[model samples]
Target: VPDITNVQVQINTGAPGYSPLETEQRITFPVETAMAGLPGLQQTRSLSRSGLSQVTVIFKDGTDIFFARQLINERLQVAKEQLPDGVEAVMGPVSTGLGEIFLWTV
Candidate 1:
């Protein structure tokens, strides 16, 4: 595969209070920039009578390598700005790790 110029990603699913606007089983998180990278996604929280969530993203990946980089960047930026106040979001290519680990070995 060629070099992956970039990748686009977001927090899909489990976004608290994100259903009203993005009513869907899988909801992508907000992003700031295209090149910007986000951390791993965590569960949403209900704190202080407020609704918020976290979404992570990355760039390097096995898929989306080549071509669609520029376009993906645009989307990332938009997602970031569009995030709600209580919603903490990030941007980047989606991450896929088939690798398994943390097994108790005797």
Candidate 2:
């Protein structure tokens, strides 16, 4: 089995009461810039709406789960400082191949 890990980040796009589109526009640039050039990052998907910005990071196969989580957190730590005011980046739960158990064939 491949050792794959998923790291997700969520950030508040603006102060309370802002419109969703406005909030997304406010934080999109900085958030994208912050997550760029991350090591071991194989792919990234992002979503922004209703004052919420979420990013999912996928690491390459065989990447150490613990190390991958730590690496992502470290990059996010620095990115936090560069984010727009009132925006806070928070990491989601750690997910690895071992965390899944369902198998099916169709």
Candidate 3:
């Protein structure tokens, strides 16, 4: 298990040149509702800007990264229809873990 971990989910409204404020208003409720009651989901923070929304899910220490991602994916799938047309949620890079970093001193 990694010492620290998080999963980032990005929601994008396919409508180009859309207003972030408007999009955020439409998505805020649905997205938050969708994220509720998910497993291993400790806390969530969200940001909305210019037709894009980002949510970061922080899990308790010792949670498996693979399971965390799977849980996120499943929840997002259920939330998809609730979002506006063309809106899509994507899971961020699984490889973002600090374990992927290498410190080498020569």
| lDDT leader | 3
TM-score of candidate 2 on Cα atoms, chains taken together: 0.65
lDDT of 2 by residue, 1-106 (tens): 6644454433334436556666556655566666677677777777776767766666666666677667767777777777667767777665543445434321
| Worst ten in a row by lDDT for model 2 | 97-106
Clashing pairs in 3: none
* Tens digits of lDDT, candidate 1, 1-106: 3333334343432346544446221233233232344232122221121133333344444434233344445555566566545444333343433211223332
> Would you estimate the TM-scores of all the predictions?
0.29, 0.65, 0.72
Question: What's the candidate order when arranged by decreasing TM-score?
Answer: 3, 2, 1
At residue 92, what lDDT does model 3 achieve? 68
- Return the top candidate by TM-score: 3
Model 3: runs farther than 4 Å from truth?
Answer: 1-15, 97-106
> Which residue pairs come into collision in candidate 2?
none
Worst 10 residues of 1 by lDDT: 41-50
Q: Give each prediction's root-mean-square deviation over alpha carbons.
A: 10.2, 4.6, 4.3
Ten-residue segment with the worst summed lDDT in candidate 3?
97-106
